[model samples]
Target: MNAITKDVEMEQQREDRRVEMAQAKDKEDARERERRWQESHQPRDNLAPRWREVAGRDNWVGMLDPFDPLLRAELIRYGEFAQACYDAFDFDPYSRYCGGCKYSRRSFFQSLDMANAGYEVTRYLYATSNVKLPNFSRRSKRNNAWSDSANWIGYIAVSDDATTVLLGRRDIVVCWRGTVTQLEFIADIVNFNQPIYAEGIPTPDRSVKVAAGFVNLYTDKDTNCRFSKYSARDQLLAEVRRQVLRYAEERGEEVSISITGHSLGGALATLSAYDLAEEREVPVTVYSFAGPRLGNEPFKERFEEILGLKSLRVVNVHDAVPKVPGLIINENVPEFVRRAGAAMPWSYCHVGVKLALDHKRSPFLKDTAEASCFHNLEAYLHLLDG
Candidate 1:
């Protein structure tokens, strides 16, 4: 062959090899993508039997739903609005009303007024709970007579529509304030450690233990031991029922209840929603932001059975609160070593449908270190606003 022909032949061979390598690399990339997809979409059988049941349930609500965008948007807006109610409690007793608080500057209720054009806050329901703290020193500089009480367990605002009631639970204010109620984390082993079903509400035939701290925070009793005479959960429910029934009688309209809260408030909201749904037989919906897990498997099962798709939990991907008191607690670990000093063999699980707002998909694990920033109500509000 001539010298030019030899050079052309060599170049042609190099081009052929390059095309072969590209095709091989493409096949490899396709296989890797398939493997990852399979891992994410694992079959139900691959999960634990109990988790299999949880996975099989059709109650989860994702952010991508097309049909219920308006409903989802409203629910999230109400969740953000609920934060204002907590802020209201931070003010003096006289300023606890919506119109008198700083949040009123950018009020969710006012926004509702503008949107509906005639919305009005008709009634405000308030409830408080007091507990005696043996270890909490009364002599501290920060301590006062009211320090032992959680003044705002929650409150319900009855709108002019008569059919809409918004329940808002107060978040933790300070370590020494009423929000300190969450610090009473001793497990109340009742009904075989399963959650004590609401009065007249049938207890499920399951063995699941829940956080007694949360339960006592919600339970109402005649005597004042660990809990007060009236719990925020019980008081809110009573007020809601009274107003709802009054509206039904006076206005001839049935009321629909919606509950929302953040942090410890979210936990109370969950407990309250369960009781309201089971006992009052009202149509109730819940939106919990950065809420901690309230119970074990049985408690979750019961909650799911009662609330089903009516509840949605908004969790930031990096939020740490939702992952704790973890689902698995080592029996051998010391109380101090465990997260939040919750030392149990088994741990709690989250209820309702989870709507995770992931800014970036890092990993499936909850990042405890990122909680301070990611678990804030502002983060949730920002996402919902978008």
Candidate 2:
């Protein structure tokens, strides 16, 4: 009987030791998990996060008053600079390449329809070379009517006493293609594995007008559609800064630049904005519509820092181009990705659209501040994330 009692006591002691061991192990695991969580949530050291904090939505109160003196002054400066550049450079609006082609026109209509359907369309156009695409054949000239592709996109206007006037008009819109040495790496990256042309490949796509003014545009195409190697990316950025500075100088204003475009133009605009910030001590603001991803995390972060609160990236839900930058880091970006990556490095803000203004009661201009795509400029200021 005593031996039995001893055995029971020993078994009870063993059970107590096991319980103590389990509790200690659990405590250790909990501590380890908390440490990891703290580390991951910690901020990194760079301009990316700093600019983001500044660019957050709370910083843009009262930005869209239109009558705001400071904002008006900035717009006037941009208008004057654009006007001078338009006057000095002879922009050929009509091109025989992409603009003049039936397929390209169809593409333009398709994009327009998307915009009309409330899908924010971001479109990009690159010249195959300097030469006109659909050369004005003698047959076309013989006919009283030029091919539909011969048309240009929008007007280049100058300011006169606070009013914008079309000083120089073209059959289409023409953007400055920087010198080959300027866009070294970017030219190579964009024009890689593409045919080299001597005459130039500026296509005459019509979407340019549809997404103008509010879009950020970028291009490195010169007389030669081809550019130098990738190492020239920095050089290209420098040239962009020079152009901004030169344009500003011509207008008798400081370096207050506003860049806009859609699709490929959006990508270029984003890149140019970043270059301006890195190469020059200027405050550059970019508004890109339906732009694609230009670089990796570093590039996006740098861009966010340069533009800060002034940068606004507008997107359409079904539009595929804007998905590029968001996808570079995450292989599969969910719709919630925007909210998930809400903690940006720079002052990057996003606006989204449900559809264009084509439906019977389209949501494009409904003025919902909560939805990113809604046209509540005032509301967007509230939602902006620095």
Candidate 3:
């Protein structure tokens, strides 16, 4: 009886020890998994102090809450006026007093009604230029005639009460005045694989490369393309810079500058805001509508580093343009096909805070099917109206 009891007691003690050992092992494994997850998710120590400072304040999450009703109304108002600048340049019979023109005046009043604030369009910047069109049907044809491109236009206005200056650029309009002028959608792929160095600042060790097409769209025409007759980017930026400087000097006070555009114009606005902010050392805010991806990851990082919390990219949930030149692509294509020539990058990303508005029901969320209608500036305006 003593031996049997002793054996039973020994077996119970061994089982208890085994259970304790298993629990300890499980705890250690859980801790190790957590450590790995934290290491991957936390911000790296190698980030520049400036980047850290700004990115810390930024909301990196996917979707942000809608702006307050008052602010949203003001932004939409500005956006409409910006679109009006394009119409004024293209359709206004008299360029002077653009605000007086039917198209521009209508937008100006619309903005006033929406904001319930005093705003005046002071200047309209218009340029007639030639843009090169890629022969998509015939890839071999390169030497095409310089088509008369009149769509590049922008406007500078001021809010009388708020004392805010607004710079607005319009998207490309499709029409036939004398000849066919289709908005160019194909990305003119060129080499843009170099670090961007600020004009006056010392070169940082790390830099990002931007897309060549976007660069050309932002850079001075003389440097961009020697053969191109029109220098819309250069002219528009110069005018903006001049007006901003003049306003600051005359008022002897800090002026708030807001740059906005839609679609292709939106890309230009992003580029312009970056350069102006860097050169002028003034806070520049950007609101782009249905804009495409501006540059690669590095370029985006640099832009965020500079603008910080000031930039906001508004996108419609159903819009297609923003998705193109997508950051992710199907990699199953043949190597030779890839090497042959693709203007866009296989992997591309977006920049700044994105506000995606989903107006339609969840069922109609196809990215490719309804892109055309969803990508329109009118669509963005309608969504912003709400």
Candidate 4:
């Protein structure tokens, strides 16, 4: 009888231990989900005041009013036309809108260059070397293997000499695409290459994950995309920030960061700008092309609070993506019509296309591509004559 009682007691104890372990695991998973949710959504505190203040300033609207009504109408119409060209490109990596179309390597490069045409032209006007180049065909390294399914992120280095000495040999253009696992590897690589900066308002707690890109996204949730891969943005940003700091210190240069991306990457860039500003007070600029909305009205307002006007610029080359910050105001409109707003009218409007076309008539395109473009020498010389 004694032996039988002991065996029963041992069995009961084992069952209780199993239940405890399961409960602990459940708690852990719940906490992780909560953390991820916070990361994916924009934080209300960051958006409220600054964004609302800037949008309400009327400075931009006032500037527009000086032009003729016909011009205003044309601007709107031209915006729509430019948008159509982007739509024709068929570059839908994030949204489900381009269901039937597929991206050929040739088409992808062509569309990319066209999209950048305006930038190239602007570079020429400023006498700066055109960073714009035609989308040349390079054999994609397993590009399509990840095409159907695989998370990817790209980083474009913009550390041109114009950026100042503080930023060193970092690539101005960097892009990466991959799943969570791939993101982790990329983050680790960035961490290895760059020194990390942990300074920022309201630092992350141990329970919270710390990253530059995702951290801002998590804060600016309302006006940004809630894609699953977005969670990695912060981690990747943390890595980049670390690198930026290392480069700045090594070169004895003041820290300045600028970020840009298209679509999902654009949304991440916006988040990154806010995070960098909040933490280091470092001057930064974010140029997002066709990024999706991250949050609600409240979040938009808060975004301005955290990221001031100088620190951020979200540009939609037409309404190619859905309604996002500083783009088409009408959210209820159909996606197709809304997207049509992306097109611009001037012959030299598209960034890459304009550059490619301009190259045919003059050596300016080739010179600008090599980064030798700068403010016009003739104009300066003419000023001396006076």
Provide TM-scores for the models: 0.57, 0.35, 0.57, 0.34
Q: How accurate is candidate 4 locally (lDDT)?
A: 0.32
- Clashes in each model (backbone N, CA, C under 3 Å)? 0, 47, 1, 75
In the range 272-299, model 3's lDDT, one tens digit per residue, is 6666655665556677777766555545
Best by lDDT: 1
Q: Which candidate model has the greater lDDT, 3 or 4? A: 3
After superposing candidate 4 on the true structure, give the runs of residues whose Cα lies further than 4 Å from its correct spot. 1-149, 156-231, 307-386
Give the clash count for model 4. Answer: 75
In the range 63-99, model 1's lDDT, one tens digit per residue, is 3354243434454446545655545443443332311
lDDT measured at residue 262 in model 2 versus the true structure, 0 to 100: 43
Estimate every model's Cα lDDT from 0 to 1. 0.49, 0.33, 0.48, 0.32
Candidate 2 worst ten-residue window by lDDT: 164-173
| Model 3 TM-score, 2 decimals | 0.57
Worst 10-residue lDDT window, candidate 1: 169-178
Candidate 2 Cα lDDT to native? 0.33
Better of 2 and 4 by TM-score: 2
Q: Which ten-residue region of model 3 has the weakest summed lDDT?
A: 171-180
